[model samples]
Target: MKLMVSFSRKKVSEPIIARAVMDTGVLINVERARIEPTEGDVLIDVPDESARTVCMKMRELGATVSVLRDAIIRDEDECVDCGACISVCPQEAFSFDSDWKLSLDQPRCVLCGRCIQACPHGALSLQK
Candidate 1:
């Protein structure tokens, strides 16, 4: 399960995420993060079975937590299998199949937005 955890100014210095990890014993894989002193957010993936527990624990620790169904959206109609997205994806989420067609592994995306920017046809976008 994927989760977006947001930290406010007061929670910035707190070891909230670490505490949640320790309390729930959930293994969190951080996929993306932009953290500074005042505020920040972290995109993480935890075991599906433990996602709920980790969400509750993170909320209890003063984090704004929300489940994420997808990090990116691809419009098949507009994409032309040009491979531009594949070239810039840091997570290697986009690929070309044996038929020379583009494919996407949505879960592998880390919300980097590189694929969207690289697409000439505006077929890819960050999930809003």
Candidate 2:
């Protein structure tokens, strides 16, 4: 099976691509440019047709691929340079660039909500 990554932009753009695999718990897509998925992006689930079907249906519906866990935590532009969430993230999922804007690595982010609970501005979200 093939995993199709759909972007919100026009079809002329390249769709995110991944091979089919089983035991994969979550598929994440990051809007920010700082973070990236290099390896081990695939979960250990057995390869199957059902997983492929789910992915296709979600793409057709324009759902952003993410683990249920990560979607619970929120990431937004209002994140101040508080550095609170960065210290507590078990997955080290949160980071900031030179501009001090928060960047979330969706693949690495498990969406534990430590950051989400800590944010005072309430800017973080797991939605697409």
Candidate 3:
């Protein structure tokens, strides 16, 4: 399960994530993060079964948690596979496989909107 964990300045100094992981015994994979001095959020992946446990632990530590499952809504038919997304993707989430087919690695995506704008066919969108 993917989660967006947000923390304020007060909570930033607290080892919230570390505590959550230790308490739940769930290894959290932090995919992306933008933590400023005042506030920030992290995109993380956890075991599906242990996601609830992690979320509860994080919330107990005063962190905001939001689940993002199948966050990317991809339209294969609308995609032309022109490599527009592949060219502009900062995380290298979009790629062309050996068969010359486009592939999307969702875990690497940080929900950046660049790919949606780069796509001429409007094949990709994020679920709110």
Candidate 4:
């Protein structure tokens, strides 16, 4: 599952994430992270079994966490399989099958909206 964690400036520098990783024994894949003086945001992929523990630990450390479900969606009917999104996806979420059909690895998607914008047929969208 994917989690979006927001940190206040006061708690931004804490090693809470490291602790969570060590405690949960799960490899948390950080897809995106942005830190500034006032606030920070991190998008992470957590194992299903450790999601609850990790989220609780994050909240205890004063970071707000939200679960992101279906962050990206594709309309099969609308998609022309032009490979436009494939070229722009930073995560390589979009790919071609053996038959050259477009496929999407939803879990690898970071919801960056690059695929949505790259789709000339307007077949992709980011779900809120």
lDDT of 1 by residue, 1-128 (tens): 88999988785456777778888888888889998878888999999999989988888778899888766888989989999988798888888999999988877877888888889999987777
In candidate 3 the C-alpha lDDT for residue 124 amounts to: 93
Decide which is better by TM-score, 1 or 2: 1
Mind giving the per-residue lDDT tens digits that candidate 2 earns over 67-90? 332454454467666777787888
Q: Candidate 4's C-alpha lDDT?
A: 0.86
TM-score of each: 0.92, 0.42, 0.74, 0.80
All models: lDDT? 0.85, 0.49, 0.85, 0.86
Per lDDT, what order, best first? 4, 1, 3, 2
**TM-score between candidate 2 and the true structure:** 0.42
Which 10-residue window of candidate 1 scores lowest in summed lDDT? Answer: 11-20
Clashing pairs in 3: none
Better of 2 and 4 by TM-score: 4
- The runs of at least 3 residues in candidate 3 whose Cα sits more than 4 Å from the true structure, single-residue gaps closed, are 10-13, 75-78, 90-92, 95-108
lDDT-wise, the better of 2 and 3 is 3
- Please report how far candidate 4 places residue 121 from its true position, in Å: 2.3
What alpha-carbon RMSD in Å does predicted model 4 have with respect to the real structure? 2.4
Each prediction's RMSD to truth: 1.4, 12.9, 2.9, 2.4
lDDT of 4 by residue, 27-91 (tens): 89888988777888889998888899889988988899999887888889999788998879888
